[model samples]
Target: MTVDVDFHHGDTIDAVFPEADVRVQVGFAAPYAAAVNYGSDPHWPPLTPMVRWTNKLGWENYDLQEADSEDALWQKVDNRRAAGDPLPGAYHLAAHIAENGTKPMLYASDAFIEASQRGEKWLEGRGYDAETPVVEIARDFANWSLELANDNLVSRVSAASDGNLQRSAFPAKVIAK
Candidate 1:
């Protein structure tokens, strides 16, 4: 939700060029950005932000479909908290979020998951019973996503060499003049 604050796309830079040393860069000017992305070790964030976030989720999401009744989310938060439900179906999620921070819901997108699965597919194609493992389901899986992407890129280049590099669609004729 916070990646592209104010619709400026100011947080991350995505670019790809062979001549360039790097193709992708993701960072934030705001100091709190990193904390939100990777999460912090169980610390209390300000309650006001938590309250605002709770209220925001309680309202109409427009086109977004929510499983529970939208208007009752905030109303049930206090009760859910009292009952010790950490998430409470997204109702008291803000309270847990304030105290424990959060996993990177956006930092590591589906691309990372696909890349991770690619390895499993490659092994399966070789007749090995391979599994992608449980990294994606782990608590710190977000951090591992980046590592997986890096590993996939390096291995692809090493395995195929320049054969994987982009080639021109048109071919040059070898006919004698």
Candidate 2:
């Protein structure tokens, strides 16, 4: 049901990645993260995170213009703080995800897979194998996510930030197995 990932990244996963995990594994920490990649079962998410997101980044300048001005945009965003539905660019509100769990994002999966293929092309003939025990089982995941997910001419960022949630991963080991 769940695969443990002994993982850690700071602030966010930036261009540099793949830092020697002698024991490779899988598993997701948050429901949204998994849902974005492989969908999820029905669940009610706490509205707090959404509100925090709005508070933190809702007032930033967008390329597209909205109703009247930045003040108007912020006012509009404030109006929906209770529901925390974000307004897309051009002053358009993104469709509310509703109370139901999010659907898997096919576009992200497609992009991720495409990125994996690119990694394979380069890893070829490199003969780089850092004792990956789960390579056979999760090769695509390891190669695509761990090996490459950078920008077209760059490595992709992988880690998810808590945003205003303020919590990040820290070193720890399970006392009881």
Candidate 3:
């Protein structure tokens, strides 16, 4: 099982679980401010400790790379945070699943769940939480038939005709709650 940690302007939970092919989890970190300029920008922040640990255990490519300009990237981050957009990465992942009708095993921690709940509440307050057919279409990828493992670690395994879990490993105890 490969583990990856992505950071952006949104709420997300953290937890561990085992599914069809691997064990995974998601979590959050302190709000990070993208450096305003490159030369002086802090070294691109390191991947979350969880991700690092996971990589050490052989999980790779957990962090997706975005090759946008610093200014552009920060602008997007600001806009999403201000607009309370779902984590763009998550959105992209969801879209990938939808388009391909493949489900990927996902694990998140309680913190990540809380963050998602907060984001949902914010959307609800803005009247943007209504279910829409487009959303159904976008979320359809979730139905592609991949196994889902949650906090319990019970290892709920399932099969996805179209998707497969990327295999990687994590160090023992990558993050603390």
Candidate 4:
């Protein structure tokens, strides 16, 4: 489901989403590994069932105060790494946040229909055929937007990152295809 895009008159994404907060990173060579985390900043919430369960196992920073403390926070991070659950560990991170009632979010408009339409129109206006598909970075908002439109943002991101274990961490139910 790859789409080919052609840029005419150098009209870029910034032109299309002007007045929208967007950031683009361009590099000469692709990196060997990749990771991107964009969402609300996470803070430890008041004790919930999940927190209590984790605490029973004696994991550090199980209490909200410990997690909230600057000194204890890094220690908790280190403890997680030692336990093989690393920071930016997408699945664990997402699950933890979901437990606290704060879940990852994808703005429907940004990552779905509107983006696709805007992309197509942008290309068309630049002389590309209306049917020409706009190519986007695999993990980018545009690509995810198109996938989300098809109700596969979770599976797609999960597949690319290894498996759907991280998908389970999302607070929302997986939409059946």
Candidate 5:
């Protein structure tokens, strides 16, 4: 199994988590804005560039629940695909992060999972594999845990345990895949 450490803006995760597993993946989430001026208008939309940074860093997956709309989410994914970038999902992320080119990790919110299970269809509508696993965390970082395991095909990790560590080890067979 592969491990991923999530860091929020202004939070230095590296300082808190042990670095014993250098092979463990690291990713950042949250919004950040940059000031820019558009052509002749002298005004620019505030753009948070975390998605682009994730693409550049080859992060396995990104959670877009903060996006205001499905269209906005598609724009980011489409832009990345058009640019020939890597945009992985839960299953893919874990595979990628594994030493054997397995998927890495999934980053999401509780709402996302609930929505998917309810057949919201937005994720599938946006070209994501509906079967992908997700790591759902709380918006406030209060409680965290993993859910949705079927025959050990997919696993989720949430911030349920102290220090946001995964309480259960990922199944060994899943990693071998």
Candidate 6:
């Protein structure tokens, strides 16, 4: 038996998990607040409501679906905070984010998943255990998604009026690439 794999023709964005759902961590913790206040563009203001709630009531998980854009993500965060839940201090809020930031594994694109499934079939036909290869493929997808997020953060930070290249967590030039 022969299996064919398509990685979506080098379209990394769509290839990762277009059809599958993705959950990302979005927080208004102090570091992120500093990024918004000091690094991001004025037009892209921080979620004031979310910020106020986070500062006073602490943070809560804002679960989002794959279709949700950055704006939609923040809106959900604001909505969740307004609903009122157990509140923590700033330190706790940060700690919670740090601890659970990558939980549930950021989902891979549907295309990536499909390709990996095919890869697994191929491996099976070859009398090999698919588990290792599938896991490796999933790890690659997760890492790629992470890199994209990190680069986007740097780009946003550098775009801010008050943003200084030296202050960026990632090199400003690399993000532009």
Runs off by more than 4 Å, candidate 4: 1-99, 129-177
User: Candidate 3's residue-wise lDDT over 1-177, tens digit each?
Assistant: 222323222232211111112222321222221111011221333333223223333433222224444455446655776888654443333334335532222333322344445544543444322233222221221221112212211232212112232322222222212
Provide the lowest-lDDT 10-residue window in model 4. Answer: 26-35
- After aligning candidate 6 to the native by TM-score, how far in Å is the CA of 23 from where it should be? 12
Ranking by TM-score: 2, 1, 6, 4, 5, 3
Alpha carbon lDDT of each predicted model? 0.36, 0.38, 0.30, 0.37, 0.31, 0.37
For model 5, residues 1-177, the per-residue Cα lDDT tens digits are 222334333333223332312222311222210111011222222222333333434445454433435467556666777888775342243233332422223333332244346433433344433232222111112121122221121232222212232223232111100
Lowest lDDT sum, 10 consecutive residues, model 3, at 33-42
Give me the runs in candidate 5 sitting further than 4 Å from their true place: 1-65, 88-156, 159-177
lDDT of 4 by residue, 1-177 (tens): 222222332355434533333232222111111112224345543233233234433444332342354455545656767888645332244357545534343323334446556655544455543233223321243333444533443443344333422222112211111
Off by over 4 Å in 1: 1-23, 28-37, 59-177
- lDDT per residue for candidate 6 within 1-177, as digits (tens), equals 011222332353324444422222222223443433333322333343234334333244346433456577566656656887433233243444445442221112322344455544543554433233332443344343334444444454334323332321221111100
Clashing pairs in 4: 111-145
* Better structure of 3 and 4 per lDDT: 4
Task: Estimate the TM-score for candidate 3.
Answer: 0.17
lDDT of 2 by residue, 1-177 (tens): 122433343432211244423233333344444444565555534333344333345543232233345555456555655566655322221223443545554433454566446645545544546453323323444434432222211211112332334322122222111
> Highest lDDT: which candidate?
2
Better of 4 and 5 by lDDT: 4
* Count of clashes, each model: 0, 3, 13, 1, 14, 4
Return the lDDT, model 1, position 27.
25
Highest TM-score scorer: 2
lDDT of 4 at 29: 18
- For candidate 1, write residues 1-177 as lDDT tens digits: 111111112221211111222212222233443454455666645433344333444532222223444345444555555777554323344456656766543333343556456644543454422232222122123233445433443443224243342211111111111
Work out the TM-score per prediction: 0.25, 0.35, 0.17, 0.22, 0.19, 0.23
